[model samples]
Target: MSKLDSSMRCHAPVPLAASHDRNARRTLWVVILTAVMMVGEIVAGYITGSMALLADGFHMATHAGALGVTAAAYAYAKHHAESGRYSFGTGKVGDLAGFTSALILGLVAIGIGVESVVRLVHPEKVDFGDATFVAVLGLIVNIVSAILLSGDHNHGPGGDHGHAHADHDHDHAQAHGHAHHGHHHAHGHDNNMRSAYIHVLADALTSVLAIGALLAGRYLGWVWLDPAMGVVGALVIAHWSHGLLRDTAGILLDRSDAQLAGRLSAAIEGAGDVTITDLHVWPIGAGCHAAIVTVASTPILSAEVIRTRAVGIKGIRHLTIECAGPA
Candidate 1:
């Protein structure tokens, strides 16, 4: 039996703690700012006896809560990155947070939809002066929050440093008769951050709608437009929430990327005459994937040769290749 008889494990390097910490601190700041604004809105709403102000205030509160979740998740993931309990580290913690936040967003949308429907059925007198001011304030806050959260910062589950080096090592080892394969997958931005950003944007959208509704009602006497705008904002929020849910849920469920799988199969088959008996590919972190390939190939086609050929494929950071009997 060749040295390749044993199963090979190639796991990608975990994301850096510094990146997670940076994002966590950013989210923490947002949470604090949002909470303070939420309290102010709620208090002012109560004093003014404006349902619009009160509703916007409560909406701000939900965003604060969701941002809190994002902050906590980043902190936890950073703290536990090296823990042995998590087989693949704690990279998925952010995804879990994103999933939960998305659920909250969906609930908020539903609540807005319901309230808007009720208001549409029976219009009420809106305190345009007070509500418009508060709505404008909320919009400014949301815009500021969005700016704070938005940027080209790469705070995702995978880091770029050392990825090329790692892949090179596999290439060097293959030359020395060692079988190894490593591919770095490029993952999208942090979903948790995206969720947080979307929350602020959604709030901002509501604020805009509120302002428009109030203005029209105050000057143009189109009171019904207020609730109608609410419905539109709710639909937008719900759409965003649904997408977030789908993405995070797919990650949590270990759903395979079909394109990635196809690339892997092609790489392996292109190497030599081999029949893939079984293959499993799953996401282990934000943009990192681990794969297991079982193949039946000619006895002369060593596992090292197969692995060497597949190493060029991107986004497969970790791989295990099992070679069985000859075809």
Candidate 2:
């Protein structure tokens, strides 16, 4: 018996995201805005001789650097998308960037916690007027940055919404689901963009907290509130960082979804007398999933027949099927 393999269903590899170019552009713009804000804050802090302003300026610089990394990731992924160097394209690049940013965010939380502890032990004199002004300015800039980074996050962080399937059979014998060839991602979540946006949100939150703490300490003599707010901000940032880390790490490691795996198995085995002997499912990119499956049947089924069974399911974009006769 002759064998025909249609290993690649797509003429070209699927894109990492539907909004790949748009998200990359948005990330670059945000990085520029953050850099500008960092410079302005540092210069103003020096002239005003306010330690709080200087601290925040330095903090902003770190996030600016992280956002710079995010921009670089996007650029690298886009330029090499069709280079054929990556076996699965550059979809996981965004996941890697998100993971790195999350680690940086975690360190920031620890640093804030330590500084707050020191401040609590040895309280600093209040230069409320200068500090408050800087906080307000930083907050405004953060808001603008947030808006620039914002997009449609309707798909949620998991990047799995009602995505259309991308199916292919090498031979012309299989004609069903041809309309679903291209990976159409209406709401593919860009992890890199989300990480950068979170940074802006964290900064804005800290600025708001700092303003309130400064006002209370200056007017009511509750100086302890300043450090207290820092602790609170640190905790909040840490929580966000942890969640981002968990999600990105899962994608990076290609964590399997048992429920999805089970469903796919049922779809194939129920098609005829086939039984799934081996199955693997993981996220490749674009809020899509790719699967490699091996099956055994009494008379041996064709790969296309098995693939056709699994088509039309949500989030499953790519599939490879192997058929072994005589289960």
Point to the candidate with the largest lDDT: 2
lDDT for residue 95 in candidate 2, whole number 0-100: 83
Cα error of candidate 1 at position 267, Å: 0.9
Scored by CA lDDT, what does every candidate get? 0.74, 0.78
The TM-score values for the models, in the order shown, are 0.86, 0.90
User: Which candidate has the top score in TM-score?
Assistant: 2
lDDT of 1 at 87: 68
Per residue, candidate 1 scores C-alpha lDDT tens digits across 1-327 of 133323334433455433455567778888988999988888877897777678777878888899999999988887887776786677688889999999999999999999999999998878888888988998888888877776635432221221211132222212222233333333544778778878888888999999998899999999999999999999999999998888889889999878888988998887568888888887767666667777776654555666777676766656666666664
lDDT (tens digit, per residue) of candidate 2 on 41-145: 789889978786787789999999899989999998888888777766788898899999999999999999999999899987878888898889989988888
Instruction: Please give the distance, in angstroms, between residue 130's alpha carbon in candidate 2 and its true position after superposition.
Output: 1.3
